[model samples]
Target: ACTVARQKSDLFHKYALRNAANLLKPEAYLKPLEQKIKNVSSILKNKEETVLNAWHYRKKIIDEYLQYISFKRNTDKVFVWIDEHDECFVSKLEELDINDEGYMDFVRALK
Candidate 1:
């Protein structure tokens, strides 16, 4: 989804650049702007991958935590609590420290 959004933004940016260039000079070349667009697109692509990876990692931790909690108490009640406060739960999960593991470090690295 992030990638798609970036692509849409890039499409708009490309046309905007072309229009401005045309207005300034009929023969104006857009090679420089094209290169910049490519650079920004590459950056967005890398960031999107990093974000998706972080979400996957967070999901792994949340699943493990849910399993642990479910075993200790009522599964339905635990699920309801998780569903009710999903944002809070995910935020806590993102900051959670797992033993000596640097899970929060990974979350912090997500751009």
Candidate 2:
């Protein structure tokens, strides 16, 4: 389960970093973020089953955490930067009204 857990963490970090970048000022550790992405890729490369599980777990965590995410008032548009590697993995982000604040605030893979 270590492999799965590790990949899960990496995925979480990536999602957190990406989401943060979208809503807040960029921080450091980008090199580590890149490394974690590679780590998850390596883990998934050798274990295909874990890859699918990682995707699902990522979706779950993102859905849960994003409800509390609030964009700064300066925001006008949301830009998604898709990695070429993740293009074919999941469907369009299933945008949802998770915040229940009269508008949608979260996006996840469709179940």
Candidate 3:
């Protein structure tokens, strides 16, 4: 589970940071990536103690995604995306059962 989560996070970073500029609609990539992270985090949640690295990796992915959006000068899209999926994102964060600074900072930033 940990390995899979790391790989998925890595792939998300690759696309989000490296290939994002090439895409005409970068926000189009956000939903799927979000879903993938949610799924991986869910799996890692069950093994929380043993998979601490995976949770940290998940945090890194979120940080990188935020950085990517800022780099593209599309900060507004972040709010739009959150608004569109606010409940889902918040609920997933709650379910993860991890005290991830990135996740907390994200929620705080949204406020």
Candidate 4:
């Protein structure tokens, strides 16, 4: 689980950075951001069950990115995705038992 979490986290970070960089480019030169966001979102959705914290972190990154973009553009599409994913991540976090030995070990290893 930890190994999978690490790998997913790495991929999320990579795409998040790439997306941010692309966003900074002039509009004419920018790459499509939707694909990068989708990639990270898919990773989070697929791995959330096994690594909650890692999923949380990656989801948070994508949420922030969406929020940032939404603020810059007049679009409702991004909000829809944010609302849907927010429910899933929140429910998962609520289900977590912080005192569990395995969970603590996973958190420690992440540190």
Point out where model 1 deviates above 4 Å. 1-5, 17-28, 74-111
Q: Which lDDT values do the candidates have, in the order given?
A: 0.74, 0.58, 0.74, 0.64
Over 1-111, each residue of candidate 4 has an lDDT whose tens digit, in order, gives 545654665676666666667665533333454455457666666666557777788999999999999786755666676666766754565478567777666555433
Steric collisions counted per model: 0, 0, 0, 0
lDDT of 3: 0.74
Which prediction has the highest TM-score against the true structure?
1
Worst 10 residues of 4 by lDDT: 25-34
lDDT of 4: 0.64
Model 3 lDDT per residue over 1-111, tens place? 566766677677676756767788877876687677767766665665556767788999999999997877776877688789988877777788769899788876755
How does candidate 2 score on lDDT? 0.58
> What's the TM for model 4?
0.23
lDDT tens readout by residue for model 1, 78-110: 778867887775577766645444765654443
Q: Which pairs clash in model 3? A: none
Candidate 2, 1-100: lDDT as tens digits: 6566666877787687777676544565565677767777667666776667888999999986665454532232232323443344333332321554
Model 2, residue 48: C-alpha shift (Å): 3.1
Write the number of the candidate with greater TM-score, choosing between 3 and 4.
3
Q: Which stretches of candidate 4 lie over 4 Å from their true place?
A: 1-50, 75-111
